[model samples]
Target: MQVFPYSIVAIFFIHHAVGLSFGSIFNDLKDTFSYYSSSLISEQCDKRWIPENITGLEDDLEKYLHGQDLAAEIIISALRSHLKKTYRKKPLVFTLHGWMGGGKGYTADFILKNWFLKGGRSKFVRKYFARKGYTADFILKNWFLKGGRSKFVRKYFARK
Candidate 1:
């Protein structure tokens, strides 16, 4: 028998109509010793999430984020009207700019959790950490070569 080592395990919540919630764990095993470069890891199909869970989300954002009411409101409004037919035509882009320890990351996390169906684990979301050891060239190379932008755009947003 072949032994497979699990490298990535992702859990997703499936809400059923019967008011029962279940968790799904997807275990993906890959061969790390191979000479191949940039092998496929874990990927989730992109899906839209309704922003009907706004009340709880607003409360959480208010509690966790201080002096960021305007930012929180903007994010929430964008999410709420993202799926509506009477919204803007272009894709919405949110930029959270701040110095270190200025709660930018925290606010971004809050937005992701509330706006996305699966929180930070949503397939529609992609996070890039701009820390030391990761330069623009390296980031672009990974984004292009590792099938990040092309594959995702083709698979998820190719239709509309």
Candidate 2:
């Protein structure tokens, strides 16, 4: 019998939908070590989130930027200066709301974008959703995929 690698164990822990089958843990397998060069937070995929040219923690999205408040004063001040120099040049007013059957890509045709937060994978919520007859795929569409660009567009594009 051979011992399984810790890296595979971590991947299973993070992505496994159900408690691991005993077979996976006990099965004979080669152990390989895999580590990331970046912090877990920075490992997030490049998502269409927030304003353009605004990569780091600076604007209203500052709340979610990892280590923003703990950053040094010099860095914070530099970020603030950058925002000031570029704020007006970029779109500022933004709105978020719910709409029904609105395809995410269609909204992007009008320049709006989607924000996919990772919280759609909460275990408590997952159980709740399952009891309500939703699988992981259904839960994802219900939570993040079915975004709408709001009814305000209706008023603006209303028939005369």
Candidate 3:
């Protein structure tokens, strides 16, 4: 008779303890999930594509690319016109060709840094360098096709 009462008391205490533990576990899980979801939302918001700053780009070009007024003017005007249009049939492309040490690479780097939020470090920017004896198609097939598609891609072919 006394044992029966003691057994009931023990069972009640055990049940209450288990219920409290389970409640704490659930609350902890809820907190973790909310933190994870909020972080994901913030990361997605940060990943949005930022627009180019044409005025700032022009200033940088004029300041850094001295004696290249003609080239800078042409590039800036073309980019401004292209960006102004809401609808575009195709992507804008630029081909820079000149003798070695003519600032082709510098111009490309500057344009990328000015155009993108993260500049050359961004995942959206891709660069492919062509080695000697590698044709354009071969390079495109092997290098470009293997990698995931990016918003901007630059290909540099070495002069034979």
lDDT string for model 3 (68-123, tens) is 78889999998899878877766677777677777777777777777766666655
Positional deviation of residue 41's Cα in model 3 after best superposition, in angstroms: 9.1
58-137 per-residue lDDT for model 1 (tens digits): 88888988888888898788767764645454655676776778777777676666655666675655677665666668
- Per model, how many backbone clashes are there? 0, 0, 0
Ranking by lDDT: 3, 1, 2
Candidate 2: worst-modelled 10 consecutive residues by lDDT: 151-160
Please identify model 3 stretches exceeding 4 Å from their true place. 1-48, 131-134, 142-144, 147-160
Candidate 1: which pairs clash?
none
Candidate 1: how many backbone clashes?
0
Model 2: runs farther than 4 Å from truth? 1-36, 39-41, 44-91, 96-99, 102-160
All candidates' TM-scores?
Answer: 0.50, 0.15, 0.59
In order, what lDDT does every prediction score? 0.54, 0.32, 0.63
Candidate 1 least-lDDT 10 residues: 151-160
For residue 4, give model 2's deviation from the true position in Å: 37
